[model samples]
Target chain A: MNAVKKIVKAREFTSFLFLAGLFLVVGIINPAFLSVDNISACFNSSMVYTLIAVGMAFAIFIGEIDVSVGSTMGLSAAVAGTMIQNGSNWFLAFAVGILIGVVVGLVNGWGVAVMKIPSLIFTLGTNGILRGMMYLQVGVEQVNSLPKEFKDMSSKTLVGRFTVYYCCAVLLTIGIHFLLTRTKRGRYFIAVGDNAGGAELVGIPATRTKVTAYLICGVLSAAAGIIFASRIGIVTSLSGNGYEMKAVAACVLGGISLSGGVGSVIGAGIGAVIMASISYLLVFMEAPSNYDNAITGVILITIVVVDALMQHRAAVNNRHARLAARTSAVPGGKEGLEQ
Target chain B: MSDKTPKLGGQNGLRRLWNGPNFRWNLFLLLLITVECVVFGATNSKFLSLTRIFASANGDLTFWYVSIFVTFVMITGGIDIQSCSIVGLTSIIIGVAWQDFGMNIWAAAALAVAVSVACGALSGFFVAYCGVQAMVVTLGGSFLYSGLGLLVSGLSSTEAYKGISGFPDSFKALTKTKIFDLIPLQMIIFLVLLLAAYLLLHRSKYGRKVFLVGVNPSAAEYSGVNSRWITMSTYILSGLAAGITGVVMTSQLGTAKSDLGGNFTMTIITACVLGGTLSTGGKGSAIGTALAAISITLLRFGMPLCFGINKQYLDIPIGVLLVVVVVGRAIVSNPTVIAWVGKLRGKGKEAKAGA
Candidate 1:
């Protein structure tokens, strides 16, 4: 009973419930959505978003944002896709893609952590530079005609009805969640984000931790890019155009606090599923695909507003309780309070 | 002491003027503008033509128009990525109202501005009252408003690709008419707006309150300032500016489309930051923004004309400029770096004495 209660009280549990409720409601509206194949497809398709959102969660955990993630992803995908289309070794292409991620992460880390530039502004600067470079390389051309086996690799499943990508992502999220919760050094991210000065006083290397967080974020986003190229079989200059916003939204939906130092990769993975499945669910509901952006916006605003209001109410109630406790502890409380 | 005061009066007076509010920054911007003009003019004689310069400046009014009011938003330590979407919303509203409803063009414009202001107020409420991050709220607003713009565009009989054109000549004259046949009317409008922004931001009590709120919100609240309202009002001003840009752009281009300002999100922020507005808030000036906008406009104009670079490649230079200028400013202002420099100078002096 205690274990169940703890599970119910977990922040990620709320996101899980939301996801389940969404699925139930959609299934009710369209029975076809309830099928095993379609349900598994939703999870399988969320692989890219899952990786991106988890990466974004790392940045948010350290109390900063990286608006350049989309551009980084685009550039990496363009590089990997172009190389693969040119008949290069897959491993070499993947290595080059990850190398691009490392370079971007280092630059972003140097600017933001070492130079102390605001992450948003610095990343936005890099975002523009990367986007320009992408344009220069692609020049209005899309990288296509990828190898058939590579494209077919996305459909390869590891377990019953679950793609290898989705299973690995879930396991990775769980492993990271375990490390973050159970390990001492892994908790440094939350500590620095919660209070940087306090963390430094306690001998944590705050700057290095922040750089590591951004590094992990960049690596995950690049991995997502490689997966994206394989799944889509084409890489346009606009491939990852607005994924940054969606990833942020996914992180928030997953119960991660934007203010930082709170949440888990598991929640982020769950949130990614919800974000990724929106358009797929919309098709079942017979809604116009054009409404996708509007719906995402509405959902984002609604969840955030509701969260704010709940936090406000909790704060008010806690204050009232503290006041009551103080008053009740005093003998002859009214006279004591007056004194 | 009395003798020193007299001896130092002239030099101190000059120093005080040099150190005056935004004086150094404004002078730097002026120097940059002059250098750009000289280089561009030297490269291409046609770039020196007054008529051509005015025309190019007039064409880029969409940027500075939004920057003027966005500077107010940034001063309050909040950002509005949604302003570009609001610009799109305003354009589509004006187009739909004038074409489909057959309303007067001016009335359509007024309605559009009102609606845009409401959009700003909504996002501001979320950011200020609900304590949501400005970036998130504005990002969501960008998506919502752009989607709404598309929905509105669907109401028009004209196809989305074609856009709504055939605007009245009288309405079109807003951009076409020039004062003295040398200066574009848009330039005059820009000057007036710049003056208005300067007065509102630098000379008004409300502006001081905004600065205080941005500098320290809880303290501002304790001091009886309605910080939330002040923050929200800046966003409204931003929305109003975006609406004006929408109308001006439509008049300038002789058409209205849902995506009129689709690609202007970064350029607007760049202009503000390049002008010395702190992205973290509490420090900015209107003159700095205007000068920055003009310099950037000239760069964009000159790059294609003089170097034969494609307009598409402009983002590279602009991005490099933003990163370098901001990072340079950070390094210059950093206390540790200052102390390091001071130490190096002291060591040099000590070595000289030992020698």
Candidate 2:
């Protein structure tokens, strides 16, 4: 039992260790890397990934994948940019952005729920479609010269340290944790993911639950896109080309099982920070920028493998528990259990 | 194989013509060609000339020219994002062997293919034997191979972006050579590749194993099949094909760049999905892939020709088409329709019983 607990703790804390290790490495490379300003900037920039990963955690927990999130984010960004250019107010532009995200999410949910298509293929398809739509709508002109309000968010440093985006990231993380732990919808998501048939037997609508997962993913991804647009102050067709991978890597590194039914919003956020720091540290260390991708890949794979091993150990422990329970029920049974 | 579901025939053919994978592929291709001819002709009458038409088509075809290997990659229930990097690596190698190393073009191409196969084998070993997820393994492979490509090219030239140009005329002649001075050699190569891929995938016994492994590895293993090696072999074939594509691209463009195939993985994967290769694996066809490549290539060139569409927005149509095809397939296969039809027929019986 003690060993099992140890394993669980290790599995949970590995991401934190990696995050700390990256921080230390960066600080070592450049003393100023640990400065409040630098740390704030890194966290602020990583907010996009954190937002998307939190959204993706819901889908991953439900045993589904959403590669289309990046493209969906792009769609929202393009929509928001176009709206902003057309003299739309901030409130209206934000609503349109969120609406596009929800619509894309609905398309994903509808395809998976109603059409019974696999999530991966359906999302892959939509990834292309959303990207195509962005292209058709935006064309070649980059949406530039943004309004003062949006630019202020991108350039402003909040609370004398962190940017507003970083604050948003913290708020999102805390909100997700509360949603998962306190809300009925959150428990329903886990219940459905843990066993769909069982959830259905208990009067839970598994399909609806799964669709909700995708819907949340859509909204979150769109939010991430809005933040990204604000940060960069530029809208390009390929802006969100590879952001999906970053989210997936973060979730995987954060002990979110790809097989689903388990993940933590806090852990995923930490994973995002770790990933962001790798690139940040590489620059501090004077390493080639390209090495950042390679290192990030390595860290992601390592975390995934460790998670898999932890799960395997848990399965073995469960099997052993059943065997011990059976033996203990027998009369005059001599059961010598060795750990 | 199930007799209960009869193949689409007669009236079904018309329906299938619009809805089936084959129909969509051909329709998209035709629509693009028509639009291209009309727009280019209006802009410049010379664009309508047979020579110019042939040139445009040839250029369009080159974009997805490497899609032949992507079909095999899809069949094995694996994806090789690294194949794009392999293309770059091979192109440079081809250049070095033919120009600097002074090897024959054919021999150089063979060497390039061999290297690609080795890289593929490494990735396949990890995926099939070690049970690593295809995505992670390939993503890592992409980085490793791309880095190597840059390094190798950098060894030969300082400007990695400019690439290694100035290949001998003979090497470019392979892509440019005309049979009867009417058709390009590149076209012939594309046809031969398509036919060979079809035969290997659809007709061969080993090919069937690939499908089984992809659909369900546990079931295949239980049935006394070594699904691992079969899956591994497909990656090897893909890598080799990437090498061939690299050589062809280098020869055709008269340059070899480390970044030649960068950002190409998404496009190839898009082509595979567009061709109806289910990402979940176990279902796809060479003919479907061929048509898909043609359509994608046409879209790349044709959209720009007619609508003055930006090249970057190309992902939009490909993305939309992918979603439409997948969602359309899903809707048609929805069980509610058949259940509704059964209920409608049942209502007639209930009414007669009441009477």
Candidate 3:
């Protein structure tokens, strides 16, 4: 019972429970969706979102926002696709893709952290610049015929039915989760986000931590771009458009506060799985895909409201518990109060 | 960060006024606009003609109208990127209601405004009451509303790409109608909106409440200001403004589409920031936003016409301008940085004197 309570009390655990409940509810509606193959498929489909959400978690953890991730992903994916399609070395193409993310991340960090510009405006500017560069890079032509090895990454299976890409992403997320929760440097992000001035006073390098957070965010987003290209097998101009919002939604669904420093990437990964599964769930329920965006919105609002209400309830309960314990400790105080 | 400033002695009030951030930014924009006109006009004489300038400026009026309202949201330290999506939603609502539901154009517009306001309320509820971050909630709103617009598009007989057209001749003339056979009608509408925005933001009690919330919400709460309602109201106002822009844009373009005004958020934001509105909130002006909008509009159109730059590359300059101006504002507004720059100048002058 204590273990169960502990698991229930952990905030990220609730997100996992929500994910399981969502799948269970959807499975009850369509038994076929409950099949092992279909369920693993959901996790497989979540690879891109999981990557993006994890990347965004770094920024959120550091108490900043990065709207530029979508564009960074797009530009990297386009560059990678173009290079591979042009018969360039795949390894070098991947490196260049990641390098693009690093540069964009550095610029974003410089603007927001070093320059003290608002994160939204600074990232929005970078978003525009990167998107424009993407358009110029892949002008009016779809980059197709990516190397078979790369394109097949999504389909490559792991132990049992899990796909290779998702397996890698899950492990990477778990590894990052440990790094965040257990390491000193990793905790710096949470410390800075919790209270920047307080952290600075405590000998934490707040600015450096924020910039490092952004750099990690950028690199992760670039990696997601490569994975996205592999899965889609074609790079269109609109390939990664509006994805930053989805990633944000996923992180929020995972119980990551936009205010920062409150949730784990593990929760984010779970939330990504939930977010990525919604469209599939809609398909199972025979709803038009056009409803996907509205459903996501509804889900986002509902989850946040529920979380807020839960917090409110918890505070009330704690107060009542404190009163009860105080009365009990006073021996006859409860009986005397009645008199 | 404080409201206090050292007063200059000997009636240097004018110089002190010039040192004020808002005044300085506006003056910079004024000078920039003037320089742009001369350079572009010198390159192409057609650009110098007053008639041509206003005529070219007509399309940008839609962007300027929306930027004013967005400036209000920013002044509260909250952003409404969803405004662009609201434009699409309103346009689609107007189209669907009038064409599909057999409603009158006027009634359809009212319906659009009401719905857009409701969308604003929905997003505002989360940000204001639930404590959700404004950016995240609005980004979700952007998705939900745009998706709703597309869903509405699915209902129209016209294919999505084809868009709905065939408006009454009067409706098409709404924006193009020449005022006194000389001035464009868009100019008149923009001026009216600008004036109204100026009074609402700078001359009203509610405006003070907005600044209070933006500067410090906890402080505002302590002072009995309902910061939640104020934040919510700004978003609602932004939505109504977006609705108006939608009607104007649809009229001006002579058609309605689900994707209309799809990418105008960047331009609106650029205008607001360039207009000297601090993204951190508590400082912005309608006139400044208007001037910034015009400067950007001129830069975008004039560059293509004068230098033969491709229209598609315009984002580069706008993006660069937003970053540069914003960073410059940050540096200039910091007293320590200003003192450093002054010290450097002092050392330079002393070295020159010794030489």
Candidate 4:
């Protein structure tokens, strides 16, 4: 019973329940969507979104945001795609792509963490610069005609009904979650985000933790970019254009507090699945694809409103409990006075 | 002696003027505009013509209009990314109302504005009353409104790509009229709006409440100011501005589409931030935003005309400018940097004494 209560109290549990409920509703509406294959396809399609959301989770955990994730994803994909299209070694292309992410992460971290610039503005700046670089690289053309093996790798599954990419993303999320919950160094992110001054007083390197969070976010986003290239098999200038917002929405849906110091990467992964499945579910429901954005928006608003109201209720309950304890304790004092 | 006294007094007055509120930022923007005009005019002599400059500036009236009211939102320490989507929503609403519903064009426009304001109120309610982050609410609002716009467009017989056109001549005259054949009607409208914004933001008690709320919301609440309402009202004002922009843009382009103003999000934010509005809120000015809008419009106009750079590549410079300028401001305003600089100056004086 205690464990069940704990599970119920966990924020991610609620999101997981929400995800299940969503699937059940969609499945009921369209019996065809209840198939094991179709359900697994939802997870498979969410591989890229999962990686991006998990990456985004780090930023949110540290109480900052990186609006440049989409551009970063686009830039890296363009770089990797161009290199691979030119018959370059795949590993080398991947290296350069990840290198681009690291450099951007460093610049963003330096601006936001070291230079003390607002994270939103700093990332917005980087977003523009990276987008410009992407345009310069891709020009008025899309990068296509990649090797079949590279494209086919996205379909290669390591587990039943799960692509290698999705499996790897899930494993990576679990690993990060373990590290975050079990390791002191990894926990510094939530610590810093919870209270930077207090964290500093306690000898935690708050700035360094923030920089590391951005680095991890950048690395993961770049990885997602490589996966995006392979999955889509074509890279356009507008590729990953609005994924940052989607990732943010995913993180929020996963029960990650925007104010930071809360949530797990696993929850973010779940949220990504939900976010990525919207279009797929819409199709099953026979709804127009144009409703995708509106549905996502509605879901985002609903979740956030619910989260706020819950927090408000909890605060009120805590105040009530405190008051009750105080008033009851006064009876003990009154008895002592009678004695 | 008398001549020297007047000159000295004048010098003192000039210094005071330079130190006045928002004057420095306005002057900086003026200088930037001057430099841009000179360089672009030097490169293309036709650029110096008043008609050409005004025409180019007039093209970006949508940005000016949106940023002017958005300055209020930013001053209240909130942002409205949904404003761009609101523009599209307004345009499509007007198009659908006039063409499909057979309503009067002006009545359609009024309806559009009302709907847009209602949209703003929804997001503002979430941000203010619900205590949700403004960024998340606005981001979601952007998606929601744009999606609604697409759905709305579906109702009309006109194809979304072709847009609705062939409005009444008098209605079209909103953008067509020019004063003295030198200035566009849009420019005059923008000026009037700018003045209204300036007065609302700088002169009114409501404006003071907005600033107080932005500077410290809890303190504002303690002082009996309804900070939430102020914050939410800013979003409404922004929506109203977006509605006006929609009408004017549709008039200017001689058509209305669901996707109109879809790409102006970055430009509007760029105008506000470049004009010296703090993204963290509590500090912004209408005059500064207006000047910044002018400077940006000129830059966008001048780059292609003078430097042969493609219009699409302009984001690079704007991005670099934002990062560099903001970072530079941060460094300059940092107390540690100030102290370090003071120490260095003191050391230099000591070194001079030793020498």
Q: TM-score for all predictions? A: 0.94, 0.83, 0.91, 0.95
lDDT of each: 0.88, 0.76, 0.86, 0.89
What local lDDT does model 3 show for residue A113? Answer: 88
Point out the higher-scoring one by DockQ: 1 or 3: 1
| Interface root-mean-square deviation, candidate 1 | 1.1
lDDT score of residue B233 within candidate 4: 92
Which is the winner by lDDT between candidate 1 and candidate 3? Answer: 1
Considering DockQ, where higher is better, how would the candidates rank from best to worst? 4, 1, 3, 2
Question: How far is B112's C-alpha from truth in model 2 (Å)?
Answer: 3.8
The CA lDDT at B34 in model 3 is 96
- State residue A130's C-alpha deviation in candidate 2, in Å: 2.5
Top model by TM-score, which number? Answer: 4
- Please provide, for model 2 over B240-319, each residue's C-alpha lDDT reduced to its tens digit, 9 standing for 90 to 100: 77777788888888888766776766667777877767777887777777777766765666666666777776777777
Query: How many clashes (backbone N, Cα, C below 3 Å) per candidate?
Result: 0, 7, 0, 0
Best by lDDT: 4
What does each candidate score in C-alpha RMSD? Answer: 3.2, 5.6, 4.0, 3.5
- Which 10 residues in a row give candidate 2 chain A its minimum summed lDDT? A330-339
Order the candidates by lDDT, highest first — what do you get?
A: 4, 1, 3, 2
**lDDT agreement of model 2 with the native:** 0.76
Off by over 4 Å in 4: A1-4, A330-339, B1-16, B340-355
Model 2 lDDT per residue over A21-112, tens place: 87887798788788877777677778888899889888888878898899889888888977886778988999999998899888888888
Q: Score the docking of each candidate (DockQ).
A: 0.63, 0.37, 0.54, 0.75
- The 10-residue segment of model 2 chain B with minimum total lDDT is B1-10
